[model samples]
Target chain A: MRDASEPGALPTPGGPRVRLLDADSAPLLVRDHFAGGDPGPIVASLAQVPELVGPTLPFLGAVLGPSWIPLREKEIVILRTSAVMGCRYCTDTHTVVALDSGLGRDEVRALRGDLPVAGAFSDAYERALISWCDAVAFGIESDIRPARAALDADDARVVELTLLVATTVMLNRYATALGLPVSVDARARLAEEAL
Target chain B: MTALATALADESLGGRVWFYTNYHCNLTCSYCLTESGPKVARRELDRATVLDLAREAKDLGFSQIGITGGEPFLVTDLPELLAELAGVLPVLVLTNGTLFQRALLDRIAPLGDADVSLQISLDHPDPVANDVMRGPENFRKVVEAVPALLALGIAVRIATTLEDGDADDLPRLCILHRSLGVGDEDHVVRPILRRGRAETGDMGVRARYLDLPPELTITADGAFWSPFAPTVRGGSLDTDLLLSRTVRPLQRPVDAMITVLSGRPEGADSTLNIR
Candidate 1:
């Protein structure tokens, strides 16, 4: 039985169900994308959507790839959404991605769902963005309108951020269901970055 | 070296290419990932770009194609686009399954052979839950479209996303699918992605990252790493995850995501939902 940290491992007792796609036989594109690396269970389970993969792939790209939202703004919403949704893979991955994007160590902590009081967040827009995402993440529909207002609806970035939040939230459930495991190296890297 | 590096070095392409047929949908489902609905802005790759991606996928040895969007059928020239795409690779269109009425189906009926299929969404067996899951009257159209589409020689499959309390509804939903002529095997049950309206309004929907699916996407925007990303919001070049501006070659960000996604197989469980 592979441990919980290992991809393709058996599900721990009482965990959400999981299924794997055969790595050797996955479509050539998927195999190549993982660089013939461990194709993880998430990749395996996508066999569940073979027919829909083509259609659904681009939405992921549009939201995760590039859009009207700026990188910093996008990350803030994503990190906040990840926290609300309890998606570990997103929180960890975005932390590294945020650090790579030049966020300070403390700011990264703020993104991990910590209190903003540690001087972790410096940008006013980011602060407002966090509040809005927090509202959105917890399913406070009415609160979202005000949060959206505070973030500035007139600015195009806010609109894009709304989309980003929506997209990440969807992915949060899918990723959580698929069980994206984190790497030991990634853990070490994120720890170092936070330091 | 990580698996992502190894995967990138192989230089293969087009196993399964996802094209955003368009970025608008007829319905505004609360949990939509793209925020697609009638009122949303329309963003679609032009005909030339679709053809360009098809050429790239064909040359790269892509196996098949998946066409997705607000509603793939909403593209003004869906039939023409499907014909062109199916000409290059086998194509499947993921839809709410509400668009194909008698007239629209007649226009594109020729491509219904092995080249195409439809994966339609239905939430619960009851019209009320499903209607609420989708929007106003979504359930009836999609449910009714299934047998009609199957009659057109088009393969039909049921795709459902179950929330926390929604699993008990699955067996019944599968039964409902059978009543509509779809078998249990033809029904695919999945978890709701905490997106769009779902994220803001769904307290029951759970979320965590899945290992990056080894899939590539193309559109007017650019080549992307994976659809299951946190999304870079900008004009295009400003984002780190844009794998390429054109289909020519992938940039480095693809490698970055794959490395993280390929890590820790043992951690692949829904319990990773960190509080």
Candidate 2:
């Protein structure tokens, strides 16, 4: 967990492998992401390598930001992917993000694998989504019938959702491998808010 | 006030405006910043565009104009281009000094009356040591060319690119340049940057965007952070230091640079001062 009380703090168990850039140190393209906001350790780490920012940031923005798919569905894919991969940093950070995206606390806990999905997610489509996320993350074959029916066999949505999961897995590996601590704002919000 | 306000006012590193006239060179130096050679594409900026940028640069607070490239002289209209640019601001042209033969010399004879000085690359005092990196006949061409250019009353400056091992040779190079009629003030020694062809080599230092000063550079591809910004690696243009693709209006890139500069932290000096 990161200490949220201070500005520009990175209290990972051991120090990060690469230099983390603050607003002053980050270049023009990346400075806005780190400037006067809680962008977290992921962006700080990315600022060190231009190749990371050049190819990664824009693609992540397109997938993670507003899109044709509902925000709830995208958040579910992100949370489930990070949870499946055991990326604690992303799971913890996205826990707050998921809630802000209108997901129930119990639903987030279910996505994190802390609570059972049956009781938390009453919707049949969401259950199918979680099952699909689990199968894709583990790289094992499973019945795609439930997701195909729930999504009404909409290949575009299915492809987009799957791509979202893949992108989250990519971020999950990067964040977890770097041992990025959760942001202070996320920790504080998680502790105080029941939502 | 922004952080770069004071720093931008100082005319040391990021003061001048740089233009990459083209990207095709005669020699393939091991540490060449742009990976330029006879085989490379000629991404040449025409004479009209250069003159237009020079006119706008003077209004934008640039004190001098620097023209560098695969070799500025490779462009046929460079001599006339330099004379016109010199009318707006003092012009400094970086060259290999190999093309100053009788015909080219006669063509560039008019520049003797212009406010222009040629900066020629001559790395070491020894012909063998210099040619090892810059190519054969480099030392001979530069040695013979400098006197001829000087005889025409054109000011010549010797720019020595020193690697770690070549630091000791500066004194000898200094004596050699002086004997060739170039004064100490006209001689410049700079370190090789770890860019383009020098990226994998075990010499020079690495310079990212923040590592260099914001000396607005205009190229055929785009406007970049510095003269060192527009580089090529593996036969592709490196866009890491690119600021904006718009180069016309000139105000667009100038404003973009100010926006970048305003964000610069205090005392954020360049690691490699190429003076």
Candidate 3:
């Protein structure tokens, strides 16, 4: 069986519930979207339903793309959200992105819940962000107070961070439920970084 | 050039401008996408609008123009409209093939010399089986029209809209279309989509925006996502696929579609892999 990191291999124990479409057979609009290179497994899987690509991608970009939150903080929320949700595809894929965005290996591992956050996150805001993500991901209403208090009182920052975490959580479920595979490039980068 | 023009120039994306010429047809096909029949309201795109859009489409980098309707031939001056539109870009008109009596065929015979082709619908090899979905005498009319249209030196293509159980008839349909002077290359076979009149039936495939490609289709109502977008169900138009209400400036809807396409994060590559 192909490993999780193989180009077309699904990370799930079995495989993807839906077939991924390659550039050759994908619709013209889809091909237009991934013109620079072959689409990642997440996109290819969604290509099975081409119409979803238009609405889904733009919404995904708005939620996860450049926003009021810093890249490091955004990755923190995303990693913790995926980790708590147990989405291997997103956890592994975003690990590479988090690292490329300047997150330390220990910080990345800690965010993925492989290690405790004692020394990994030195910033109070980051620590609070992680707690908020965990609280949100697990749907624990009471556990959100300490984190919300420690995080700054900037309403915009809190909302942006909350939406980021929420969107990542939704993506984690989608990627996990679909049994999407980690790309070979992302997997190689993860290995190289020893994460 | 604008972002929309640049996107349209990519041949792989299939930048075809479509016009919904009219919305009334002679027959009430069971699976008509627009629910076009003799009794349906005639929401037509006039000749001037088509010619104007064609000119704008050519300037905007669209490669071809497609004209569809409940039936395009029902438009009194479709041949002249087609000639004007074809002068701007290659043209394809979708028709039921049932309207080509001697006089109408003679009128459209001039299209043979223009950069235009007609795609006529023929669902089955057996006339009875085909007419069951398309209406009575459909198969005979298409069979007769293909030879007559071809004799006028016009290009003809046969489109087969198949139901789930109709796969067995394809080989026979191919042979039938070939015998009528249409080559195998000119035969189009696709699943009848569950839209408009076919929505209540289990005979066609389910269609959704996510599953369908974005083609800039302009109707009398507005610009649509695809020719399949401006559908009529229960005597009301389905707005699920309407792109923009203002299509006159042409840039309005083209930009709307471009805005939607630009949301893809993977970005675009340069290659005309699809035609």
The candidate that achieves the highest DockQ relative to the unseen native structure:
2
DockQ of each: 0.02, 0.05, 0.02
In candidate 3, stretches whose alpha carbon ends up further than 4 angstroms from where it belongs are A1-195, B264-275
For B1-275, candidate 2 gives per-residue lDDT tens digits of 33233545663337688999999999999999899999899999999999999998887667889999998899999998999999999999999999999999999888999899999999999999999999999999999999999988899999999888888888899999999999999998888998888874656887767678778899998788899878877775665576666788887777667767766677676777665
Model 1 gets an lDDT of: 0.63
In candidate 2, stretches whose alpha carbon ends up further than 4 angstroms from where it belongs are: A1-27, A31-195, B1-7, B11-13
> How would you order the candidates by lDDT, starting with the best?
2, 3, 1
Model with the higher TM-score, candidate 1 or 3:
3
TM-score order of candidates, best first?
A: 2, 3, 1
For residues A1-195, could you state the per-residue lDDT of candidate 1 as single tens digits? Answer: 122234533343344354344442233234443456665444454533332344466776777665665676677778778877888767776777777777767777777757562377766667777888888777688988888777745666666677788888887787787665655556788667653
Q: Which ten residues in a row have the lowest lDDT in candidate 1 chain B?
A: B230-239
Model 3: chain B TM-score vs. truth?
0.94
Candidate 3 structure quality by residue, lDDT tens digits, A1-195: 112234545356777765555644454346665576566776876655555677888898988988766888888889889998999999998898898889999999999898998788888767877888898788776877766877775888888778888888888888888888777677688888777
What is candidate 1's CA lDDT for residue B35? 62
Q: Per candidate, chain B TM-score?
A: 0.80, 0.95, 0.94
Candidate 1 regions with alpha-carbon error over 4 angstroms? A1-195, B1-14, B203-212, B230-275
Which candidate model has the greater DockQ, 2 or 3?
2
